[model samples]
Target chain A: MLEQFGNFLVHGLVTGSMYAAVALGLTLTYGILGILNFAHGEMLMVGAYIAFVLTSRLGVNFLVAAVISMLAVGLLGWVIERTTFRFARHEHLNGLVISLGLVAILQNIALAIWGADPLSIPPPLPRTLEVWGIRIGEQRLLAFGLTVGLIILFSLFLKRTRLGKGIRATAQNAHVAATLGIRTERVVAVTFSLAAALAGLVGALIATIYTITPFMGGLPAMKGFVVMILGGLGSVGGSILAGFLVGVVESFGGGMISSIFKDGFGFVALILILIFRPWGLFGQRPEREDV
Target chain B: MARRSWQALPLVGLLAAGVLYPRLLPGDYFLHLGIVVSLYIILTSSLNLIMGITGQFAIAHAAFYGVGAYGSILLVTRLGVPYWWAWAAGILLAGIAALIIGASTLHLKGAYLAICTFAFSELFRLLLDNWISLTNGANGIIIRFVPPPIGIPGLFRFDLGSRRSYYYLMFTFALVTVWFVRRLARSDLGRVLGAIRQDETLALTAGFDTRRYKLLAFTVGSMYAGLAGATYAPYLSYIAPDLFDVNETIYIMMIMMIGGIRSIWGPVWGSILLVSLPQALDITPLLRMIAYGLVLILVMIRMPDGLAGFLDRLVSRLRPGGTWFGEKA
Candidate 1:
C-alpha cells in the first residue's frame, strides 16, 4: 500500500508539472490580455507538430527541434496579434470570436498538413527505473525537470525584468500604463508571444509522454482552460497550485475510478468553483458588482 | 396596432416563403437543406438574444440544444411519452438546466462566464459520450417514430413524416422565435439589455440589477435553443455528442456574428447562408471544415457587423430619410 501510494505521488508530480507548463501560458495571456485565447492549445499542437517534423522528417536533434518549435509558435502568436487581434483589444467577445476562429483554422491547418496520424518524439530515455519499490522512468523525470526549470525561469523573468513589469502593469491597468509612457501594445504583443512560446515548450515536453496528434490539443487545451478557471483566471499562483491539485486528483481518480472520470474532475472542480467563488481560488475580487 | 401590423409584414412574408418555397424548389435535398437552415437560424437567433442583445457570450448554447434533444428523445423512447409532451419536457429541462447554470455563473462577467459555459457544455458532451447506461455511450439512442403535433382530434393534424413537413415545422418555430426576440428587442427588457450592453456600470447605477436581467436573458435564450433542439431530435431521429460540441457552439456564434448580433433577423439570414453554403459546395468533409474556418475569418474582416448590418446599410442607402447606419456608424 505504501509503495503504491509513493508511486502515485511521484507520477502525479510528473504529470502535474507538465500540466502546469501547458497551463502557465494560459494564465499569463488571461492576466495580460484579459481574453482567453481558445487557440492556445493549437499552439501546443503546432509546437508538437514542428518537433515531429524536425525529428522524424528532417532528422534534427530532439532538443533543438523543441527549441525551434517554441520560437516558431512564438512568432505565429506575434503575427496573429499584430494582424487580427490588434483591433479587438478592448472588445472582449470579439477577441474570443477571433481566437475561436483561429482555433478552427489552426486545427484544420494541422489536419491538412500533418494528417490525423499520431506522432511521437524519437525514444531516447530508458523505459523505467525502480527505486525502493517506487518505479521511476527517465522520460517522466526529464519532463518534470523541464517543466520545473521552465516555471522557475518564467518566475525569474516575470520578477526581475523590465518587460515583465510592463506586462504586470498592463494587466493591472492598460490605460494607466500607457499614460505612464509604457508601450502597452508592445507589452501585450510580447507577453502574448512569450505565452505562446511557453505553451509550445510544454507541448514539446509532453509530446513524448502522450500521443501527438493534430486534434490532441483540444482536450488538453480545454483542461488547461478549466484549470485556469478553477485556479482563478489570471492568477499565476492559482494556476500552479490548481495544476498540481488537478494532477493529484487525476492520478487518484484514474487509479481509483477510471480514466474518463479523471478528465471529468476538472469540469467538476470548475462547477464547484463557479458555484462558490466564480472569481477563482486566488483571483482578485472585482471592485464592481455588475461583473 | 396598425403600426404593429406593418412591422410584421416581413415576418409574414418569411413564413409564406418558407411554406411555399418547398413546392417551387426542384429537389428533396434543397428542402432538407432548408430544414437545416431554419434549424440553425433558430439556434443562432436564440444565441443572439444573449450574445447580441444582452452582451453575454455563452459557448454552451449547443449544450442546451443537446439537452432538449436528449430529453425529448429519451422521454419518447424510454417512457413512450407522447410526442408533444416529450417536446415540452425537453424544452422545460433545457430551461431548468440553463437556469441552474445561469444561477451559478451569470454573476461573472465577460470571459469568465464564457469559459464557465464552455466548460459546462464540454462536461455535458463528455457525459453524453460516457454515460453508457443512459446515453448508450455515443452509439446514440434512436427513436421509433417522430413526435406528432399536439392539437385537435381531426381538423389540423400535422404531417412530420416527411422532411419537407419537418422543414415547415422548424421554419414556423424559427419564425416564432425571431418574432419573440424582435418583440423583446423593441420592449423595455430589450432596451435595458441594450443599455446594459452599451454601459453596464451606468445601467447598474440607474437602478437596474444587470445580473438579474442578464440571467433572464441567458435563460430565455437557452429556452429558445432548447426548443430548437427538441424539434431537432424528432426531425433527425438521432443525436450523437458530436451535434453539441464546442464547434457547433462556435458555428452558431459565427452565424450570429456574421448575421449582425443585436439585429433581430441577423441570425436567421446568417444561418441560412452558412448552412446552405456548405451543402451547396458538394465537397469532402475535410475541406468543408477548412472552408468553414476561412469563411468565418473572411466574413468578420469584410463585414464586421454581419449580413444584417450589410443589408441594413443597403436599405439605408435606398431610403433617404433612414440614417440607422449613419447614427450607429
Candidate 2:
C-alpha cells in the first residue's frame, strides 16, 4: 500500500510538472495577451512532433532536438501572434474563435503528416531509480526536475530581466506600456514566443514519458486550463501550486476511485472550484469589464 | 410593402426548394445530406440564441445535444418507452441541464464561462463514456427500434423508416426552429437578450433580470439542441459519446459564426454551406478539416458577423434603408 502510494505520488509529480509547464505558458499568454489561446495545446503537439522528427528521423540528440523544437515552436508562436491574433486582438471572442480555428488547422495538419497513430521516442534515459521499494523512471524525474528548474529560471527572468519588466508593464496596461515607450507589440510577441517555448519544452519532455499523438495535447491542455484557473489566471506561483494539486488529486482519483473516469477529475474539480470561487483560488475578483 | 413582398419572394422560393428537396434529388445520399444539414441548422440556430443573442459563451452545446440523444435512446432502448415520449423527455432533460449549468455558471462572464461550460461538456462526455453499465462504455448504443409513424394510424401513417421521411422531419423541425428563433429575435425577449449581449451591466442597471434572461435563453437554446439530438438518434440509429465531444461543439460554433450570428438566417445559410462544402469539393476529410480551420480563422478575423452579416451589408448597400432577412440592425 505504501509502495503504491509512493508510486502514485511520483506519477502525480511527473504529470503535475507537465501540467505546470503547460499552465505556465497559458497563464503567461493570458496575462499578456488578455485572450486564452485555445490553440496553446497544439503548440505542445507541434513541438513534440518537431522533436520527434529531429530525434527519430534525423538521429539528433534528444536535448538538442528539444531545444530546436522549442525555438521552432516559439517562432511559430510569434508568427501566429503577428498573423492571426494581431487582427483579432481587440475582440476577446474573435480571438477565442481564431484560436479554435488554429486548433483545427494545427491538429489536422499534424494528422495529415503524422497520421492518427500514437508515436513515442525511445527514452533517452532508461534507468529507473528504486528507493524503499518505490521505483521511479529517470525520464519522469528528469521531466519533474526540468520543470522546477524552468519555473525558477522563469521567475528570475521575470524579476530580473528588462524585457520581463516590459512584459509585466504591457500585461498591466498595454496602453500605458506603449505610452511609456515600452514597444508593447514587441513585448506581446516576446511573451507569446516565451510561453510557446515553455509549452514546447513540456511537449518534448512529455513525449519521452507518454506516447506522442496529435490528440495528446487536448487532455493536457484541458488540464492546463483547469490549472490556470485554479492557480488564479495570471499568478505564476498559483499555477505551480495548483498544477501539483490537480495532478495529485487526479492521480489519486484515478488510482483509488476509478480509472475509467480518470480524465474527468480535473473538470469536476474545475466546476466545483468555479461554483464556490469563480475568481479562482488565487485569482483576484475580476472587475466588471467587457469580454 | 413593395419591398416586403420582394424580400418574401426569396423566402418563398427557399421554402419551395426545401419542400421539394428530396423529390428534386431522389437519392438516399442527398436525403441523408439534407437531414444532416437540417440538423446542423437547428443546432447552430439554437447556439446563436445563447452565444449570438444572449452573449453567453457556453460551448457545452454538444453535451446538451448528447443528453437529448442519449436520454431518448436510453428510454427507448432500456425502458421501452415510446419514441416520441422519449424524445420529449430528452429535450426536457437537456433544458434541465442547461438550467442547472446556466444557473451555476452564468454569473461568470466571458472566458470564465466558456471554460466552465467547456469543462461541463468534457465531464458529460466522460460520464457517457465511463458509465459502462448505463451508456454501454463507448461501444455506443445502436438504436434498433425505428420511431413509430406520426398521424392517424391506418388512414395516413407517415412512416419514419426511410431517409426521405427523416429528411422531411428534420427539415420541418429546422424550419420550426428558425421560425421560433426569428420570432424570439423579433420579440421583447430577443431585444432583452440583444441588450444583455451588448452590455450586461447596462442591462442590469436598467432593472432587467439579466441572469434570468440569460438562463431562459440558455435553457431554450439547449432544448432545441436536444430536439435536434433526439431526432438525430433515430436518424443515425446509433449514438456514441465521442460524437458529442468538444470538436462537435466547435463545429456547431463554426457553423454559427461562418453563417452569421447576428441574425437567424445566418445559421441557415452557414449550415447549407459548411455541410455541403466538403462534399461539393470532394476533398479528403483531412484537407477539408484544414480548410474549415482556415475559414474559421479568416472569418473571425475579417467577417466577425459571418456570411449573413456580409449579405446584410451587401443588401443594405445595394438598396439603402432596406435590411436583409431578420432584424433591422
Candidate 3:
C-alpha cells in the first residue's frame, strides 16, 4: 500500500510539474497584460505540433526541435500580442473575447493541418528506473527535472535580468513603468513571448509522455488557469505550489475514488477556492478598483 | 398614433415571414435548418441578456442548455413522464442551477467570474459524461418516443410528431423568447441591468440591489437556454454530453457578438447569418470554422458593436436627419 502511494505521489509530481510550467506562462501573461488569454492553450498545442513535425517528419533531434518550437511559438506570441491584444489592451472584456476568437482560429488551423488523430513522438528516454522497489519512467523524470530547472532559470531571469525588472515594473503598473523610462510595450511583448516559450517547452515535454492532439491543450490550459487562480493570479511562487497541490489532489482522487471524474477535481477545487477565498492562497486581496 | 402603427408594421411583417418560412421553403432540409436557427435564436438572445446587457461574462450557457435537454430527456425516457411536464421541469432545473451558480460566483467580476462559470460548465459536462447509470455514459441517450399532441379538448389538436408541427412549435417558442426578451430589455429591469453593466459599484451607490438584479438576469437568461434545450431534444432526438461543451457556449457568444449584443434584434440577425452562411457557402466545416474565427477577430477589432450596429450606422447615414428609428448615432 505504501509503495502504491509512492507511485501515485511520483506520478502526481511529474504531472504537477507540467501544470506548473503551463501556469507560469499563464500567470506571467495575465500579470503583465491584464488579459486572460483564452488561446494560451492553443499555443501549447502549436508548440507540440511544431516539435512533432520537426522531429518526426524532418528527422531533427528532439532537443533541437524543442528549442525551435519554443522560439517559434514565442515569435507567434509576440505577433499575437502586437496584432490582436495590442488593440484590445484597453478593454479587458474585449481582450478576453479576442482571445476566444484566437482559440477557435488556432485550434481549427491545427485540426486542418493535423487531423484529429492522437500523435506522439518516440520517448527520448524510454528506460524505466527502479529505486528502492519503486519504479519510475525516465522520460517522466526527465520532464520533471527539465521543468524544475527551467523554472529556476526563469526565476533567476526575472530577478537578475534588466528586461525582467521591466516586465515586473510593467506588471505592477504599466503607466508608472512607462513614466520611469521603461518601454512598457516592449516589456509586454517580451513577457508574452517568454510566457509562450514556457508553454511551448512544456508542450514539448508533455508530448514525450502523452499523445498529442489538436484538443490536448484545452484541459491542461484550464488546469493551468486553475493553478494560477489557486496560487493567486500573479504570484509565481503561489502558482508553483498550487500546481503540485492540484496535481496530487487530482491524482489521489482518481486513484482512490473514481478515475473517470479525475478532470472534474481541479474544477471542483477551483469553485471551492473561489467560494471560500476569492483571493487565493498566496495572493493578496486585490484592490476594489482592480476588479 | 401614426408612428405607433408604423413601428408595428415591421414586427407584423417579420411575424408573417416567420410563420410562412416553412411553407415557402417546402423542403425538409430547410425546415430542419429553420428549427436549428430558432433554437440558436433563443440561445443567443438569452446569452445576450447576461453577457451583453448585464455585462456578466458567463460562458456556461450551454451547460444550462444541456441540463434542460438532459433533464427532460431523462424524465421522458426513464420515469415515463409526459413531455410537456418534463420540459417545464427541465426549465426549472436550469433556473435552479443558475440560481445556485449565480449566487455563489456572481460576486466575482470580469475574468474571475468568467472562469468560474467556465469551470462550472466543465464540471457539469464531466458529470453528464461520467454518471453512467444516470446519463447512459458517453454513448448518449437516443430519444425514441414522440411527444403527444396538445390542444384544448375538441378545439384543435396540434401534433408535435411531424417535422412541420415541431418546426412551428420551436418557432413559436423562439418568438415568445424574442418577445419576452424585448419586453424585458425595454422594461425598468432592462434599464437597471444596463446601469449595472455600465458600473456595478455606481449601481450599488445608486440604490439598486445590483446582486439581486444580476441574479435575476442570470436565472432568466439561463432559463431561456433551458427552454430552447427542452424543445430541441425532441426535435434532434439525440442528446450527448459533448453536445453542450464550452465550444457551444463560445458559438452562442459568437452569434451574440456578431448580431449586436445590446440590441434585441441583433441575435435574430446574427443567428440567421451565422447559421445559414456555411450552408449557403458549402464550405468544409473546418474552413468555415476558421472563417468564423477570422470574422470574430476582425469584428472585435473593426466593429465591436457588431453587424446590427453596422446596419444601424448605415441606415442613419442614409437618412437625411442621420438617425435610425429615432435613436441617435
Q: Please report the candidate that would top DockQ against the real structure.
A: 2
The CAPRI classification for model 1 reads as acceptable
Off by over 4 Å in 3: A90-93, A288-291, B1-10, B151-157, B320-329
- True-vs-predicted CA distance for residue B266, candidate 2, Å: 1.4
DockQ of each model vs. true complex? 0.49, 0.60, 0.54
lDDT of 3 at A108: 91
- Candidate 1 stretches with Cα past 4 Å from truth are A288-291, B149-156, B198-205, B208-211, B282-288, B317-329
Please give fnat for model 1: 0.47
Q: What tens-digit string does per-residue lDDT give for candidate 2 at A105-163?
A: 99999999999999998989999999988899898898889888998899889888999
Clashing pairs in 2: none
User: What DockQ results for candidate 3?
Assistant: 0.54
The local lDDT score (0 to 100) that residue B225 gets in candidate 2 is 95
Candidate 3 per-residue lDDT over residues A1-291, each given as its tens digit: 888788878888889988988888988988988877878898899999999999999999988999999999999999999998888775665676788878888889989889999999898899999886668999999889989889989988988899988888888889999999999988999999999999998888889889999888888888898888888867888899889989988988889888989888888888898887777778768667422
Better structure of 1 and 2 per TM-score = 2
Order of models, best TM-score first: 2, 3, 1
Report the Cα lDDT for residue B47, model 2: 94
| DockQ, prediction 2 | 0.60
lDDT of 2 by residue, B249-299 (tens): 988987887888767788888999889988886788888888878888898
| Clashing residue pairs, backbone N/CA/C < 3 A, model 3 | none
